[model samples]
Target: MGATPEEGAAESAAALDEVAESLVSLWSLAHNAPDVPVPATQLRVLFILEHGPVNVSNLAAEMGALVSSASRLCDRLEAAGLLLRDHGRDRREVTVRLSTDGQALLDRLKVRRRDDLARVLDTMSSPARAALIWGLAQFRDAAKADKGPGSAGESFSLPA
Candidate 1:
């Protein structure tokens, strides 16, 4: 008899964690390269901004950081020409949007990351690569199904 779907998912969770760890390691190394314009946290802010403008308070919540901390992060990014802050409808409210430079930087970082992963994928057997591609698509489908509407899971996708 086959394992129940829940049991199968439970068994896969640890393996998923291992894969996530390895990918994070790769991302950290690539993100910290000397030429990369921003640190990881700032890059995260930039990525979030790339989606669209966000209110200062909401950005803080998204990052799980205090409003002051989020504002400080925005300060550095704005100083670096990576983003713009504007007063929202209420004069006291602040909103942030990624600058053109920030978008370019994010694009470069993504390309670098893809290249790094491609290098690793290049060394794998064709069959292994095929299996990985198929497995990841299935996993993505299942994950999307499990997530509620407008959840961050929607933001997670394999690069083309």
Candidate 2:
């Protein structure tokens, strides 16, 4: 037997609520993480820079933020010695890249976060972990297909 339309709708709504609550919990955990002094926004900027040096305007576009806002974020990261800005080959453009300290910090944070996640996952059954990995992979693929290259919306999704 199939579920009624109303039942299906209710289930979907409940799933969305659960996802929202999980996101809040994740944010709280990240906020309380040790040795991670930067705000989440700055961390995201550093993560992007870690991939490769990008021009300020491009970074702003990718982050979906105003140029001035991105500039302010860059300034804060630079002040923390986590990023470097240098003149581009065009001389008129500025390129932003992560500094060694930035890389070190990111690496440490990644490891710590991975360990924290692993600890939580350890309590779950293997099948549950596999299901999570599979679900997230499918969600990522769907998101990438929906949003073109350089789109930021790939970060959020709900599993069906």
Candidate 3:
């Protein structure tokens, strides 16, 4: 008999996790070959900032961290010229944005990572590469449709 739908999903999710780990390892190797300017935690902050400017509390919530810790991270990134902090629409609030240099850094890293991934993909059979692309497109569409725990409104908490 064929696997149940839930079993197939679990197997696919597990495989995707391994793929994600490999990709992360590849990115880390490529990112650090030239010495990354920011710590991993701060890099994550920059990634979140890439979406848009956010205040400390929201950023902290997204990172599952305390506001004080997030502020300290921003302080470090700001000191390194990778982040900017400005007054928010509310007089008492401060918002953080990635600086131009930070964006450039991200852009360069993306190029390098893509080049590396492309090299790996080049070694694969044509059919395998085509399958990978098709699978990834379908997975992306599924992810966009889910809007579950990872959605912005949940902010780290899963639905009951």
Worst 10 residues of 2 by lDDT: 151-160
State which candidate has the highest lDDT. 1
**What local lDDT score does residue 145 receive in model 2, on the 0 to 100 scale?**
67
Question: TM-score, each model?
Answer: 0.79, 0.79, 0.81
Off by over 4 Å in 3: 147-160
Residue by residue across 83-136, what tens digits does model 1's lDDT show? 999996767899999988988888888888888989888999999999988998
lDDT tens digits, residue span 89-136, model 2: 778898999999999987877676666668778988999999978976
Clashing pairs in 3: none
- Using TM-score as the measure, the top candidate is 3
Model 3 gets an lDDT of: 0.82
Tell me how many clashing residue pairs each candidate has: 0, 0, 0
How good is model 3 by TM-score? 0.81
Number of clashes found in candidate 3? 0
Instruction: Give one digit per residue, the lDDT tens place, for model 3 in 63-150.
Output: 9999999999999999999989999677689999999998887777778788888888999999999998898777666665666765
